[model samples]
Target: MQFSADTMFPGDLFEAATRFAADTLAAGDRANAWQQAVAMGWPALLVDEARGGAGGTLADLGAVIEGCARHPVGLPLVRRCAQAPALLMAAGSAGADDTLRALCAGQVDLDVVDAPALTVTALADGGVRLDGVLEGVDAALPFTHVLVSAGALLLLVPQDALPAPTARFVGIDGAQIADRVLSGLLLPASAVLQRGEAASSAAAIAQDLAIFATTLDMAATLGATIEQCIAYLSTRVQFGVALATFQVLRHKVVEMYVDYESASVLLARLVADTVVTGRLAARDVALCKLYLNELARRGAEASIQLHGGMGLTAELPAGRLARRLLCAGFAQGDRLTQLARLATEPTAARL
Candidate 1:
């Protein structure tokens, strides 16, 4: 069945989020963003109502994401509202209740493990040892706990158990990122959040949810960028006429808008499928990511090329928007990695 975005997500939530993000999306004001998110009850959108949350649906979450896309904030809203909640629900661990409450209250922030760099060793006494470096992690927020998956086991490691991050700096997208160095960090049996098949399943689903949220956010931001470009072109005069009057420039802006529209349709379908099936198809999610990456690159170039020198400066919103579009690919796996994954999929899935 075809999905209509208007029918799926609530209008009021999107409007409210748009209003909130407009005033608070500026960089270096993470505390204000967090406070506003809490006030809006965004962090609890996915947690069950009984668990002191809003008991909202995925569509509700999408509404807020769409609104925030007007100006993307650097908060961990995707992880907090989508990934962690999915992980906790899939694990069915009562012990996660306090963590959920803390998250709802904005008392703690959580980050996902990068998975590849870390080495995990299981102890006979039900403990685990971790040793390795997590490179270029966006743990700049006061992340109090980390969600980690070691093979078929999932563990929640407290921030105190690991050393402080190094080489910290604000990224182009205004995220405070650093490299986390882990040396023989050990956690007791109680740290295990899930094990066996449950852990593996939980980790996969959580990541899928996160990808869904992220793709929607990126697409919305691209749409906003397209709007900004149109506004600038219509007003900026050149060669005795507006830039929008130039056929070449008008065509480029149209192309960007078309790409943004395509992404919006794909996101709508993905959201509909998830709400109905309660799961995301990995292949579809990867396809969305790859498509958005390509779209972002194209949009970024067209935006910068059209804006000329102004696009190169940080003082303008066009430049900042383009930077974010380009950076989205690097946040998870780059285009090359995603291409390889698709290349390795089964023949039927590929078809």
Candidate 2:
């Protein structure tokens, strides 16, 4: 079935994403979209075909991520595609396993648990235990088993395995956010996806990619929002003339475009470096993410200002972009955290 939407698409491949996001994703065919995404070879984009994946590359995944961003789809394609395969490879376990096939087949969704507040313990049974709280966890949600992070190790946990959350809050973009106290939860040795150096390595790499993807998607949304803002201003009339005729509004749009392009180039370079070198390129990714996060916030503010009063309401795209701008910056690491991370990286220099 072909997906369709009432909105004007950005054209070419972007139209498919816009239609898919608006009609399939936004309409809440989440499970079906998961299946469709996998069927479309999204989850397999980063995996080797020998391991039941496409063996494409990170650059391919970046393109998919950019498409999703332009339309703001809610699928967990990043976790399924980049993070899972990267972690599996890091953990030394991507050898045509059933898990990998299942992932490629879209039968499962794996999520990384990189919550800020967490603790881990070793179980006497050669297993591991997780304690403390995980805040703002949006995945590993209800009704499905998912792989999660427990300190340096990865664990396959049932959704029903954990107790009820201690607190729940709605994301600014309407995503489900919760703080769960994960005490007394234990997993056997088989549940541990990685340990020691492998675990840390997998986490650093996967987390960096995940953060990169998130920030880039935010940037794409900024692009679409800018387009919408410009479109609105061109037709909107004030004082018996089009708002776009105003020099002040035109300057704001130009500023937003400059910021957007700057972030886009940085993110593209980071993606290319990761793909070509097959390394985290952590410092570069962090810098790009930091810049994009700030850009999203600044661009959203500018778009809202240019769009006038209705910009504050959900009825307008500006409000949604604003919410995404506000949230995505902190969802990954904020600018200060990135700066500190950069400072600690070995041989850090040259901004």
- What TM-score does each of the candidates earn? 0.89, 0.86
The TM-score of candidate 2 is 0.86
lDDT of 1 at 215: 80
Instruction: Give the CA lDDT, 0 to 100, for residue 249 in model 2.
Output: 91
List the candidate 1 regions with Cα displacement exceeding 4 Å. Answer: 1-10, 26-28, 105-107, 344-351
Residue 88 lDDT (model 2): 67
Question: What's the CA error at residue 294 for candidate 1, in Å?
Answer: 1.2
| Predicted structure 1: clash tally | 0
Report the C-alpha lDDT of model 2 over 198-294, residue by residue, as the tens digit. 6676677777777777776777777777778788887889999989889999899889877777766666676666667676567777777777777
Give each prediction's root-mean-square deviation over alpha carbons: 4.2, 4.7
Clashing pairs in 2: none
lDDT of 1 by residue, 143-190 (tens): 678877666877788878878886677778777767778888888988
